[model samples]
Each structure stands twice: as structure tokens, then as C-alpha cells.
Target: MFTGIVEELGTVEAVEPLADGGRLTISGPVVTADARHGDSIAVNGVCLTVVEVGEGRFTVDVVSETLRRSSLKGVAPGEKVNLERAMALGDRLGGHIVQGHVDGTAVLRATEPDGLTRFEIPERLSRYLVEKGSITVDGVSLTVVEAGDREFSVALIPTTKQLTTLGVRQPGDEVNIEVDVLAKHLERLARPQLDGLARGE
Candidate 1:
């Protein structure tokens, strides 16, 4: 699990193809300071297990399922990525509970800028969003400032823009999206009741 708070902006050092998966060597000095083999780290909201650790880099194996669900499939060396260590017990929930399990990917439809500020929302994942609801985009926690049937917007402060990948996002870019877990649970719980009402039962 994670808090959706980005700890560092790491880079992909290398990528090697494996038979059923692939090995990624990512450079993250802070997250690997005390890291060891078999530790889990959240990369761009995707939980990855550490296979080896060096000076400031670590290796992780990406299975086919993860590749299909995230934007990591075509990731190349030198690409910047968000990094966060798994949430420890008793830690303050700075952001919402992020599973690092991406629900899907969204396409950047547009960016509205003001004062070097911007709001970048996905056209595909807008339905799950609501005003003031929590969202994880590229592993950074943000709130929806506005929403629509096919698009939602988030106001990005300068710090967030500089520290994470959202600062560089452009129209037509793909981003990993993890919807609020609580909202999903509530929807599941209400589904049957709503169905019964529709049936006049």
C-alpha cells in the first residue's frame, strides 16, 4: 500500500526483455538507501518488487499483466518516473490510501494553464471522478477541481508541478490512474440496492 505521495522523481536506467516479463533498472537514491532484495516499492503507482539494489538503483521484474495495465510497457531508459516507498505501519496518511495497483490508464485530453499552473485530467477516466474527490495521477495525489462526463480537472500547485511527472504532461499523453478506493467500495455496496429499487422490489 501507499499514500500516493511522491517521494522522488526517479529515472529508468535500463530495461531488459525477459521471456515472460522484463527487468527494469530504476535509479532512485532515496527509496534505495536502505533497500534490500524482495522489498516492494511503488513506481508511478505500480507496486514493484526489488530484485537487487546497487548504489542508487534497483532492479525489478515486470510481469505481463502489469505491463498491460500500466504505462510501463513501452517505458524506455532515461524516462522520469514517480517513486514512493511502501507505507509503513502507523504512518500518517498524508494522502489517500493508494494501493499502487493502477485501475487503468487515461489519455490527457487538454491542459488549462494559468500563472504557470495547470489542470490535467483524463478524458477516459472522468466518470469515476467527483469534485473534491481524491485521485492518483502518475503516483501523485491530487483532488478533482472539476468534472464532466468525459473529462475532469485538477489544479496543480507549483511544487507538485515541479516535483512530479504532471509538470511535463502534454495533450495525448497516457497516465496511470488509480481511483479512490473508498468510492469504489461504496459503489459496490450500493449496486445491489439500486438494482432492487429499479426492479420495484
Candidate 2:
């Protein structure tokens, strides 16, 4: 698991296509310092296992399923991505519980001068979002400022803008999104009661 806290901004060094997936080599000096084969690294919010490690770089295979579910499908050489290694057992959860599971992708709709950014998400995922709730965007944990039917906004501090991939996001770019796990748990637990109410029982 990851904490949605970006450890470094890595650059895509190469992308090699496979029959069923693709291999990506990324340059992240910090995250690759102690990395090894089979280690998991969160690359732009998608958990990818390390296949090989080299000087200041590591490679991971992206299966078709992961490619379809994340913005990584559009990644290319020269792209910058947020990178975070799996959290240690005793490490601080600086951000939140980020499973490195991208629920879906959201499109960048707008960005304000004051660091407020809005994203257009699928209507189906709107129920999981709420004002002040935590949301992981491209591997960075942020608090929602506003929530709407298909859009939500988050305020980014200067540190976020400077340290993560979010700082350079442009309008129309797609970002991997993971909503709060607690909200999903609550929904699942309440489903029976909600279903009974719907039946007027």
C-alpha cells in the first residue's frame, strides 16, 4: 500500500510494447535507490511491480487491465510521473490510505491562479466524493473543496504544485483518481438498509 504521498517526480525513460502489455522504464533516483525485482512502486497512482532495476531507474510491466484503468495508457517518453514506494510497516501515513488502485480517470477541466483545480469525473463516481473529503489524484492526496454531479475541485498548496506531477497538469489531461476507501466501505455496509428502505419494508 501507499500513502498517496509522492516521493519523487520521475521521468519516463522508455516504453516497450508487448503482445498483452507494455514495459515502462522510469528514472527515479530516490525511489530506485534501494529497489529490487518484485518490489512494488506506485507510478502515477498505479501500483506496478519492479521487473528490473538499473542505475537510477527501474522497469515495470503494465498489463492491459491497468493500462485501461489509468492515465498511464497515455504516458510516453519524457512524461513526468509521481512516484512513491510501498510504505514501510512503521512509516507515517502522511497522506491517507492509498491502495495504489486507480478507481478511474478524471479529466482536468480547469486550474485557477490561486491553485484551485477542478476535474470532471464520471457521474457514477460522484457519490464517493464529498466536500472536504480526501481524494487521490495522480498519486497525490488532496482535499475536495467542492463536489458536483460530474465535477469536483481541490485546492493545491505551493508545495504540491512544485513537488508533484499535478503542478504541470494541463486542461484536457487525464488523471488517475482513487476516492476515499472509507466512503466505499460505508456504502457497502449501508446497502442492505438502503435496499430495504427502497422496498418500503
Who wins the lDDT comparison? 2
In order of appearance, the predictions have TM-scores of 0.92, 0.97
Off by over 4 Å in 1: 115-125
Q: lDDT tens digits, residues 102-185, model 2? A: 999999999877768999999888889999989999999999999999999999888999999988988999999999889999
Give the Å error, residue 59, model 2: 0.4
Candidate 1, residue 18: the lDDT equals: 93
lDDT of 2 at 88: 98
CA lDDT for candidate 1: 0.86
Question: For each candidate, C-alpha RMSD in Å?
Answer: 2.1, 1.0
- Model 1 lDDT tens row, 1-201: 899889999999999999888999999999999899999899888999999999999999999899998989979999999999998899999999899889878777666654322334455556578988988888988888776776667788888889998888887788888988887888889999989999998
